[model samples]
Target: MVAAYQKLCPETLDGACRELADRDPALDRIYRERGCPPLWQRRPGFRTLVQIILEQQVSLASGRATMKRVENAIGRVTAQSLAGAGESGLRAAGVTRQKALYCTLLARAAMDGELNLGRIARVRDHEALDMLTAFKGVGRWTAEVYLLMALRRPDVWPAGDLALAKALQAVKKLPVKPGEDVMRTIARPWRPFRAVAARMLWQEYLCRNRAASAASG
Candidate 1:
């Protein structure tokens, strides 16, 4: 349950990274050997959330391509533009039918003043997740992603993320990818600093992947 005002900045994230390392020696070794993770913060707003929605179950490159085209088509990603763009136009913008439907629902909600992101930020994490997910297209993973990066909630661990799960598996040397329950149990020790640990693991995941790619090349 993260309070809005208790968001993590770069300085706080640095302290949190150290705190996490101290709690887990293996994670500590990563931190000591590799550099610290970035404070992955996003501005809380409609456009950002919309971008996140476009990113669902897709590669970042794919998501960005779609988002850029959509933004170009609409000139903006506001409720008015989205609602006015219509389904065909959105499809022309490179989004799937499912995503267009999702965009429509989100836009209507936003325009109707149904989704109060700012107020929700002040509430508990579950409450915030609930409020966001109550709308169409937003799920637990999406909601948690918003909480972790957009709202900068300290304790959120989006276990549903494949990247994070894979990273955790590789870092912990698990035989197989852990399920949500297993991920939760493994993440329990990180507690309030789970987001920080997640950031570190994500960085390590990318670093190792890049090295592997380079070696293969």
Candidate 2:
């Protein structure tokens, strides 16, 4: 289980925002303007893990649609069910061939006890990340997201996320999107509250998108 200090609640989010505002003017502006970001939490398990896998390189809406189809097809998104689905069943659920392979690999690993998520739940962040990433289809981004959204880890930062980079650029008014290294560097100041900072960035991105859509409409 995650430590209470590491988990994000409304109180933690507020606390993080206050600390961020004290340290950085840009983040403070976001806190004052956009209000607090949502407590975006997910249940930590096979379903969420596979959903994150489907989210790779896709829009959030698309990922959610695909995950819905997968859930409909299998009726239960578990190791056994996913293992039984195989590639064809997954393909039938609108999963891409490569993603099917990746999901299957993860399912097989879980089924074979090669990867035990339950056992790793209580481990340190580094160990949890390593355990999650040891399987195929679960990269640094995926692992970090799992830690952030599902585990509610406060300090996790997914620097490789394109949306996050875009959000950062829009907030900072950068001419170009920063690279992953630059994103990581930018997040250094956020430190223990990086996940809260990430939520703020995502919220900014959403607000900007809504405004642009309204203008276009």
Against the hidden reference, what TM-scores do the models get?
A: 0.95, 0.96
Instruction: Report the error of model 2 at residue 91, Å.
Output: 0.8
Per residue, candidate 1 scores C-alpha lDDT tens digits across 1-217 of 2232468888778888888888897689779978689887888988888888999999778888899999899998888899999788899988999989988889898888898888888998888988999998998888898899999898898988888888889888999999999989999998888888889988888898999999999
Candidate 1 clashes between residue pairs 3 or more apart in a chain or in different chains: none
User: How many pairs of residues collide in each model?
Assistant: 0, 0
Model 2's alpha-carbon lDDT is: 0.90
Predicted candidate 2, C-alpha RMSD: 2.2
lDDT tens per residue, model 2, 99-184: 99999999999899987878767787788999888888899999999989988889889998988999999888889999999999
Measured by TM-score, the strongest candidate is: 2
Cα-based RMSD of the predictions, in order?
2.1, 2.2
